[model samples]
Target: MVKVTYEIVPHDGGWAYKLGDVYSETFASHDEALEAVRIVVQEQQVGDEPVEISYQDESGKWREEYSDGGDRPEVEIIDRFRPGEASV
Candidate 1:
């Protein structure tokens, strides 16, 4: 399984969570951002029905495949403002 981490940090004069190079929308406060992360994590845990998925490959060719609902990456949230930690 793939491991995904949501890192909470200050961004755009507010707070937001980042996954790899992507950042979520900014929240007014750290607590608000943390709450948003909690909601996202909870939603991610809910499995969906398997269905045919389509995507474009690097060569610009369209590909379609059946996806398994049970297949999902493990995820966690990391708070950057915790005590004894200077950064995430």
Candidate 2:
């Protein structure tokens, strides 16, 4: 996991993140931040699954079934993953 710092800024009508990639979100408040992170992580995780599932067909042939319920996963609090670093 790559560590990154996100900047939260006041946008046109609300708070936004200057660096939200596939793993982070920006907010004006702690509550909003928490919610956004939760949602982003869940959504991403559901989007990262392999698209095709293969299995043996009737003729012993491999068949593929499309998987539609997976998503890419994201990480939060990069510092949490720092080596030899403890977060309190």
Best by lDDT: 1
**Model 1 clashing-pair count:** 0
lDDT of 2 at 74: 35
Give a tens-digit lDDT track for model 2, residues 19-57. Answer: 564323345564465456445445555545457788998
For candidate 1, lDDT tens digit of each residue in 10-75?
999999998998999999999898889888877887888999999999999999999788777688
List TM-scores for all candidates, in order.
0.81, 0.33
Best model number under TM-score: 1
For candidate 2, report its TM-score: 0.33
Clashing residue pairs in candidate 2 (N, C-alpha, C atoms within 3 angstroms): 44-72, 45-72, 46-70, 46-71, 47-70, 47-71, 47-72, 48-71, 48-72
Model 1 Cα shift for residue 39 (angstroms): 0.7
